[model samples]
Target: MGRTSDAKEKILSAAQSLIELRGYSALGVAEICKAAGVPKGSFYYFFESKEALALAVIDEHWAGQKQDWTGILNSDAQPLDRLRQLFEVTEAGQRAGQQSCGTVSGCLFGNLTLEMSNQTEAIRTRLQEIFDAQVEMVDSVITEALARDEVAVTDTREAARSVVAQLEGQVLFAKLYNNTHRLSPLWANCLALLGARVPQEALAGS
Candidate 1:
């Protein structure tokens, strides 16, 4: 891409990493520019405001993740297995985050919501949309499982909501405790919610 486009991406990448590591309100334009190796003056030329940059960051992150989610969740594998695989991916991602930031930063969407929702309506609205889309993906998986008789029929959408919410809680707690291995409860809860036979280790908090 051209210099302008490349610079914009650098700014977004820098801001995304910093904000995920710290928080939106804690990191400023200068910090992002420095990390991005771009001039501070160029930030405003690319993004109208910090909120604009944050919104773009969310979009960029979600766009990159969509393909991975589609490949895993929309595959021909058993729906419940697909769901389980999603968690496996999440576990690896959490570990990677810890390695990169020296702590679990948790889901960007969840982190941004807690940090910015009460402070910025524009950002809150953007986050709500992303969150709803994620829940819809989960809902679709549960619905598929029901259609295939892979699991007992229940409110698939509600089940999706519960799974997503509980996983986010597990992520938050894992980060709070500074340990990425605190995802055992999430596995057990998710399997149980889907009517799958929960692993004994997961049941015993292993």
Candidate 2:
């Protein structure tokens, strides 16, 4: 049972990494099996089809992201500072990917949203829920900030969605251009959009 679970875990990790690198439509089961060091028979034993495996991948990705987001969004710092920390985390991840792959790989959820949304109903529905959940998390942070008078956002939900959309759009552009510079101004721009204080250091460095 331990080995069986390990194999499933490896397959999920490999498929997610490959999907981030190559996109969903371009990868196949054989490649996934090879990358995971699992046999085709074992893959089927765990997942009924590629679509099922993709759904698992989405679950895995969101679980990990939510864990991090919980910490960032629930911090005791000022709400805008927590939002700054989230963008810092994103820029760091993209920079690390650029250092490794010579390009920013972008967010997996956004990637799947663009690729498989129209083709797979189950995957598309799951993606929608995940993104909506993410937006709600951000909205909570925004609402709290509004309550405290730490930041000013007229419509909490809309402001949160705009921030998310801007970040995703910046990541897509950076990945498309294979350059992290495309993301340089994004953090500052997002702060401005929310009418949050543009910290001097963030404005100067970013």
Candidate 3:
């Protein structure tokens, strides 16, 4: 039983790394099993299909990311400061990935959205739900900022969507250029989207 569970985890870990590095369309079950160092039958035993495995990978990755995002965005810091820390954390994460793998992996959901979302209804729907949740998280922060008169936005929801969009777009640019510097503009762009009322010097320290 322990070995069976280990085989399942191996498949998931390998599938995630391969998908992150090369994407979903190009991989095959045989290759995934080989990478996982498991028998091909183990892949079928754990996942009914390649798409099922992909969904599992996405869910696993989101579980980790959601925790990180929630911790940062929901922290005790000031609202705008929380947003700035979110961007800083994002940039730092990308930089760390580049250092470890010699390239930025960008956001997994964002990558899969561009690569496979349009190709499969299941993937498209799942990606939409994930993104909507992200927007909701940001909306909460913006709502708090608005209450405190820290931002000028009248439509907090829309502003939050724009901020999330900007974050994804900048991450895409970082992956495209293979340079993490592209992410440096995310905080400034987010402030512009929110029309933040905080003084520049005040935010600079964050």
Among the numbered candidates, top TM-score falls to: 3
lDDT of 3 by residue, 80-188 (tens): 8898899899999999989988999999999999999989999999989999989999999999999998799999889999999989998999999999999887787
Candidates' TM-scores? 0.91, 0.91, 0.94
Model 1 accuracy (lDDT, Cα): 0.84
lDDT winner, 1 or 2:
2
Scanning candidate 1 in windows of ten residues, the lowest lDDT window is 197-206
State in Å the error of residue 155, model 3. 1.1
lDDT of 1 by residue, 1-206 (tens): 24998999899989989988888899888999999999988999999999999999999988877777888899989888888788888888999989977989888999999888999999899888877887899899988878877666479878888889988998998889988788756767787777754455654344
- Which 10 residues in a row give candidate 2 its minimum summed lDDT? 197-206
Ranking by TM-score: 3, 1, 2
Clashing pairs in 3: none
Q: What tens-digit string does per-residue lDDT give for candidate 2 at 1-206?
A: 34999999999999998999999889999999999998888999999999999999999989988899889999898887788889888888889988987778999999999898999999999998988988898999889888877667889999989989988998999888887778777768767777775565655345
Please give the lDDT score at residue 192 for candidate 2.
73
User: Who wins the lDDT comparison?
Assistant: 3
